[model samples]
Target: MPIYIYWGEDDYAIERAVVTLRDRILDPLWTSFNYTSFPPEQSDAAIAALNQVMTPAFGAGGRLVWLMNTTLCQNCPENVLAELGRTLQVIPENSFLLLTSRNKPDERLKSTKLFKQLATEFREFPLIPPWKTELLVQAVNQAAQTVGVRLTPQSAAVLAEAVGNDTRLLYNEIEKLRLYAIEQNRPIEVDTITRLVRNTNQNSLQLAAAIRVGDTGKALTILADLINAAEPELRIVATLVGQFRTWLWVKLMVESGERNPGAIAQAAEVANPKRIYFLQQEVQSISLRQLISCLPLLLELEVSLKQGRAELSILQTKVIELCQVCRRN
Candidate 1:
């Protein structure tokens, strides 16, 4: 049989799909499961590994062969593609081959004889971002429910706020929350939600807080920590920009006489009410026109860094400089 493929846009659904596949395929059919994952750059080695896995166990019932975490389709070299196409053509029926990726296969490969044959013989499931908030909530709830933990509406809403659209991080937080609940023997109440679900790495939050407070020294300190953690400079920039935007919005909401921080934070999905203070300050410090103008400059900086017009470290420096300037104005 040809290889079955499953892919996802982000880590959570991708991981769930892998877990589901493993549960469904293993244990029932065979004694031994042979699984391997390949990096994108190791095309030749990946092809070799696949061959080894698909080579029958000889007189045994069969084996499950898996290639996980590959980016072959996204960045495969021309010569490697030709070799892969040949290798894929002859996978035997006794072995089950599965390939999971975060990337879609190349269009050229999709049209090739090998991919066509594989597509005809095996199933392909692509994991997409949840189209609705209910879907996203259900996924988190299901994961929690499996662990005998339940989320209150407010807690679930808080979790959603912290996660935004990053289900991978959401799932990770859920796992942590589940473990914490089991250990502590407490229901996930609103106060518990405030402490746990809204939590983030102190550095990321500190950086955001510093930007909100117009504290260049604090922002730079947090930025350094993020960089040392190997966060991409571009990601840091994007995150800072996002926080600034939120601060501007919250400030506007407050100035318009919205006294309830919870209501304002709820609208923006900020789980922590205390965050309102910093957010309100950011709005007060700058005008709406200034915030609007700063966004494009930040975008240009991102483009320059990614396109090699600027070094990553230099880009971070520029980001700090720009934010400091904004604070002054």
Candidate 2:
């Protein structure tokens, strides 16, 4: 019951715990350690290894056992999970057991006898993203500082947008930015951030980018893929409308004495700060008339789709036609 669990998709939180355990508790004191990563598909050997690792010996300083990326409760065979629970009951206090997972365990398990006892004896922390601007900015700053790279306010916003709430991807992208900065011997810039990080929202951003750039061919390709994936036209239209609004805000903000993309993004409340620069540039080419006119068309199409005035085939044709009209305007 001494197994502490730390769960999140946030890589930095998981990494910090891993490093702390390794450095302060395990490595410094010279405890023998075993780290096992159990993906959803590979539970058998991982569970068996955990059983073997936690079996204590009199002379051993203690074992440090780490189970990573496990989804045992959700996907494992019932017999296997039951065996795992039974195994958890016997883990030696002298041995430190750690579980790192992207998903939380079931609520039933959380209230069950074994988990209740484990909770009493062990610490549990969830490192979900804060989903607020301030915390996201702090995360970006902390990650950049780790590598001695300094971000201009604009650069930080770009990095934030490109990484977008995926802490693991943010760290990886920051590391890549660090490498790029070192290789080029330059301060980190927005373009460098854009070049390195591929955010989870990249496709949506790409669609926006293509539309902004008047790349009808690219826009059509992106539209076709979304249509094939069965994404609702109304939803797609709504997203684009929102993106374009953000772009317009950035454009307006920049022209009105707010030259920094980050500042504009913060003021506009755009979720992806990193996109502000591209958006600003993109918005410059779009006339106010086009922005005003296209939105109504998207809205009309949305209503039409909702009313079943057209099937997906017709809806897709309308989308392409909208793209052409927007680009031409």
Candidate 3:
């Protein structure tokens, strides 16, 4: 149980997990001697890490060999795979091998299958998509608990809305709240969270909501707020695209008489089927045609942003056009 595979888009979460694992495996005094990290930029890092992990700890602690941002599971060379197979079979009990990646390991790959057979732990830390409100709220609560801060349910929801899927920000905010709660000697509430957390009121998801309702003025205002807050233009467009795409799929499924939430959730690639109910309600007013139309416009907006067009004005124009599309009968 020495091999670990951690992969996903949530880099912050993965790093945090790595820190925890490192702390558990290596003594603080002997860390420098026993801990070895192979960054992805290093040539032959995977092989190097394998070789390093096979070596015993220098002193009083177990050894930890980390292959950070590795792609071995996705595309391991024949030599590397053979080495990995040999290493895993005889890897020392006191030595740990950790492989981390941003991409999901292709399960079809032989390397992935080999890892699955011998991996002590395999965990994915996927970012909660902005549109998945429930998961975000759950993430907020879990982070708060980990940071030793107690949050009212309402406060958790508010914080989730504020941070969206930014795990780093969420953890920082929770730590801040924990410190404030200690000083104030009170439980964290919605009001406290609202006042303390920056950008609590505006986010890309709010922009998507405004566009969903065809509120041109509201969408523009949110767009301005997001821009003023220095949210990336491309990120804003990505959120919109994801939101609209989800709505389109849900709408298409519902209109075609598909009532099973699980089926619809699968089609939309949503994690929780229960959220499909809320999504169904959101898309009830808009036609599938309108949802379908928004994608091309969003694509154009993304293209314009990538093409080095003025961000605010370009975003403003696209938001207005999107609102207009949703408004059409």
Q: Which candidate is the best by TM-score?
A: 3
lDDT of 1 by residue, 1-329 (tens): 44666655565665666676656545544444444444446646566666765576444455556666665555665665776767666767655666666665665653233554665333343432222244455556766776577788767755664554565667777777877787666568767767876444333445655664467776777676666655556656666566656765676677678989898888756656776776676577676655665677667777788788756566666657656656765
User: In model 1, which residue pairs have backbone atoms overlapping below 3 Å?
Assistant: none
lDDT winner between 2 and 3, please give it. Answer: 3
For every candidate, C-alpha RMSD to the true structure in Å: 7.2, 8.7, 3.2
Cα lDDT computed for each candidate against the true fold: 0.62, 0.63, 0.90
Q: How far out, in Å, is residue 305 in model 2?
A: 18
**lDDT of residue 106 for candidate 2:** 64
Q: List pairs with backbone clashes in candidate 3.
A: none
Misplaced by over 4 Å in model 2 are 6-20, 23-25, 28-50, 57-62, 75-90, 102-104, 109-136, 165-169, 176-203, 206-329
Tens digits of per-residue lDDT for model 3, 259-326: 99999999998988998999999999999999988999999999999999998889999899999999
Candidate 2 CA-lDDT value:
0.63
RMSD (Cα, Å) of model 1: 7.2
Candidate 2 structure quality by residue, lDDT tens digits, 108-213? 6532335546642333444423223445677789878986788988888777756545666777778777777775655787776767666434444466567666
Clashing pairs in 2: 157-274, 158-274
Tell me the lDDT of candidate 3.
Answer: 0.90
Looking at model 2, residue 192 earns an lDDT score of 69
Indicate the residue-level lDDT of 199 in model 3.
68
State the lDDT at 1 in candidate 2: 49
